[model samples]
Target: MKVNWFRRQHPLQNGDQLRCHALAKSPIPAHCLELFQKSYPAPNSPLSELKCVVLDFETSGLDPKQDEILSVGMVDIHYPVMSLASAQHYYVQSEQVIHSKTAVINHIVPETLIGGISRHQLIERLVVSLSGKVVIAHGAEIEKHFLRHLLQLDASLPLPLIFLDTLRLERSLMKYRGVMYPDLRLTHVRQQKGLPPYLAHNAFADVVATGELFLALVEEICADKPPLLGPLVLRSL
Candidate 1:
C-alpha cells in the first residue's frame, strides 16, 4: 500500500509516524485515531505478518438502522497461525421486538437475551478485540453499518473498522478470472470452491466458515507473492 518503500532506503521511523502516515491515507474516524494512536501497526505490514480477525453477526433484520444485532462471533487468524480456540461469541440483550422472520434466520430465541450482555457492553468488548487488527467479514457493509450505528452513540465510542469482505473479494476474483457463479451467498461460494457446507445463520459457524473460505480464496489472488492486507483490499475494489 505504501509505494515509497521502493524509493528510499526506508528511513527508520517511530511507531507514531508510521501509524499517522497510514491513518492519514485512509478515512479513519477521529475516535478510531485516538484509540490506535499509540499502537497502530505499520500500514505496509504484509498479510502474512498481520493479525486477522473474521467476524460475523446474526441480526434481527438486514437494516442496521431499523434492526438490531443479536449476536456477534469472531475467530482470529495470524496468517499461517490460526487460533480457532480463541474464538469469541457474544449475545446481546435487547428490549426491541424480534419477529418470527428474524428468528427463522438467526435462530436466536428471545429467551437467550435474558442475561445477555447489554449492547453497550457488547460494543466495548468488540472494539477491544478489533483494535490493531485487520478485521474481516463475509459481507462487510452489514458489519460496518451496524458497528458505526452502535458505536456512534457518543464521542467516547470508537468504531474504527474496515473489513476485508470475502463476498466482495470473491466477486472481484471471479471477474478477474472470467468465471461466473449462480450466486455470491456465503454458502453458494463455499460450495463452488469445493469448501464444506455449513449450517447457515449461526454467528459462530458463519465466521468459522468465512475464515476458511478467505484463506482458500486468498491463495489464488496472492499466488507466489507475499500478500499485503492493505493492497488486497484495493484489489477487491
Candidate 2:
C-alpha cells in the first residue's frame, strides 16, 4: 500500500493490461467482470479523450485496514468539464460506532448511518459506474487503499487502475516553482486556484471541489500543448 508519490508513473504496459484481461474470466462478480472487459485508454490518448471520475471517501480513520468507509461521493469529469448530472453520493452502513471527533468533521452520526446502504451494495454500484474510467482524487491513497481492501481481489491479480492525484500533482508543481513547502489541502488548493469554496467535510462537496481543482490544474499542466494520459496519470493501482 506504500506508493511513491514523488514522481508521476506511466500507464501500465500491455502485459499488465493482459493480466487484467485474463482476470475478467476469473470467478468474479458480473459487474466487476464487465468493468475488466472494458479497455483501459491507450497511453498516448489525449487527456480530453479520457473519461474520469472524481471521487472522495469519508472514513472512520485513515487506515483502510482498520477503518471503515462512512460515505463515498463521485462526479464524472472529461478533462476540463465536470458533469453535475452524473454526481452520485452514498453513505455506508457499518457495525462500527461513530466517534464524536470523527462525527464533528464528517457530520455523520450513528443515527444517520443507520439508514445508509450496505458496503456490498455501494461497491457494486461503484464498480458499474467505474467501467473503463480512470479515477481522480485530491489525495488518491485513501480511496485506492479502501477500494482494494473492499474488493478483496486476489493479491496476485493486477489492480489495473490509473489514479490521477491532484495533491501530488500540485506538490510537484510547487516544487518545480521552487517552493519548499506548500499547503496541498483540498479547500486550500481550491482557494489558491480561485475556485469558490463549498462547505467542507461533506463527501459530495469535497468531490465537487476536487473536480474543479482538477480542471484548473489540467489547464496549467496542458498550457503548452495537449498532454497524453501517460503524463497526467500520477499512479496506478
Candidate 3:
C-alpha cells in the first residue's frame, strides 16, 4: 500500500507504451515525435546494454519559468564504459543579465555566453543525442523541468521519457536502510561514495562527476552483474 501510494505521488513511466499513447495524441512537436519514434529498452533489458547520456545544466536560477539556462554539459556512457572523448559542453546565450550571485556559484557570466549557442539550437542537439537513450542526472527534476518548459509542450501531456535519476536512486537506497535526511547533494554523495572530487559547479566537470557517481551507485546496488533496467529508471514527473 505504501509503495503504491508513493508511486502514485511520483509517477513512473511504462516506456514504449506511454510513447505510443502519447504519439497518438494531436499537436505534438516534430522534435518530440522524432524522439518518440525510437523504441526504448524493454524493462527486462540489462543495464549493461543501455546507452546512457549523463547531463548537467547550469542555470541562472532554480525557477524554470523565470530563470534561464546558462550552460549544459553531457557525456555518453555506453553502460559500464564511459569515455571523456564523448563529452560535449555548450554555453547558452540568454537575454537576461547574469546576476552576481549566480555567477559566483557557476562561474558563468554574460561575457562567457557571447560566443554561445541559442537555446533552440542547443535543444535540437540535445534531442538528437537523447534519441533512444536514457537520461541520467544528479537531480533530474531540474533538467526535466527546464527541458519541458523550453520545448513549450502543453503541461497536460508530460514527455514520454525515462530518466535514471542518481539522486532518487541514492535516496531510495538510504530509505531502505532507514536513513532519513541523508546528505544527497551531488558533491556530498560523491564524497561519501569515495568518488574523487571534480571541479564543482562547472557544467562539464559536473556532468563527469554525475556520470562517475551513477557508475558507482550501480556497482554498489548490483555487484554481481548489471541489473535489469526496470528497477532503476523513473519518470521524474
Candidate 4:
C-alpha cells in the first residue's frame, strides 16, 4: 500500500458546483464486496453511539481544480473493539490522469480503474456511509478542504457531520516537549508512539493506522483526565 504523498492532488475549484450523474461500472472487486457485506453495524448498537468514522483519502495531485481523488477509505469506530469488519474502502474513476509518481506508489494505474465509479457516485456513497458519524482524519486540513470543496460544488450537500484531527491530538499530547517535526505527519506520530507501521498510500491501511494512533493518544490523555471522544476532539481545537 505504498502511496506517493508528494504527488497528491485536490478535487475541486474554489467555487465549482458539486454535481452528479449516474455512470455504470463493473461490479466492485470481490474482496471489497465481501468487506462491504460484512461492514454493517451490530444489530443492537445504537447509531447515536457510533461516534466517528476514521477517514483517509488518496488523490491524483494537490490543486483542487487540477487533481482528482483516487480512493477514499474509512473505519467506523464504535469503541471497545476494533476490527476489519468495521472498515470500508472505495476506489474511484478519476477524470484526471494519474501522475507518474502517484501511480508508482499507489499502484492504481489508469487502465486498472477503467470501470470504476464516478466522483458523484463516490461522494454520495461516502456521505451516506458517514451520515451520522464524526470524521477523524490524520491531517484535518486536507480532508476539511476536500469536504468544503464538495460543499461548494454542491450547495445542497450537507457539510460533514463533525470533524476531528488525530494530528492535533498527537500534538496536544506532546505540548510541553514540543513536536520533533514541524508538521505532524501520521507516519512520524506512529513511529514515535511505537504504534503499528503505516502502509503509506493505501487509504484503508492509513485509516486503520490513524484509528490505532487515536486510541493510544486517548489512553494517554485519559491517564491525566477522564476520557470522552467528544472532549478529546474539542481539546484539540
Candidate rank order under lDDT: 3, 2, 1, 4
| Cα RMSD to the true fold for all candidates | 5.7, 4.2, 3.4, 11.9
Q: What's model 1's lDDT at 179?
A: 75
Can you rank all candidates by TM-score, best first?
3, 2, 1, 4
The Cα RMSD of model 4 versus the native structure comes to 11.9
> How many clashing residue pairs appear in each of the predictions shown?
0, 0, 0, 11
Q: Can you list the residue pairs that collide in candidate 2?
A: none
**TM-scores, one per candidate:** 0.80, 0.88, 0.91, 0.71
Which 10 successive residues of model 3 have the least lDDT summed?
Answer: 6-15
What would the per-residue lDDT of candidate 2 be over residues 12-75, giving only the tens digit for each residue?
A: 4553455465675556545456656666776788888888998899999998888999999999
Per-residue lDDT of candidate 3, residues 196-223 (tens digit): 8789999999989999998898888777
Model 4 ranges off by over 4 Å? 1-50, 153-158, 180-183, 224-226
The C-alpha lDDT values of all candidates are 0.75, 0.80, 0.83, 0.64
Residue pairs in clash, model 3: none
Question: Which numbered prediction scores highest in TM-score against the true structure?
Answer: 3
Q: On residues 1-237, what C-alpha lDDT tens digit does candidate 1 reach at each position?
A: 344653342221233444455556555555445445535444466888778899988898888778998999989998856688989988999888889888887888889778888986886777778876778898888888788787663433334444688988888888777877637899988998899889888989998999998888888778887877656666544
What candidate 2 gets wrong by more than 4 Å, as runs, is 1-9, 21-31, 234-237
Candidate 1, overall lDDT? 0.75
What lDDT is obtained when candidate 2 is compared to the true structure? 0.80
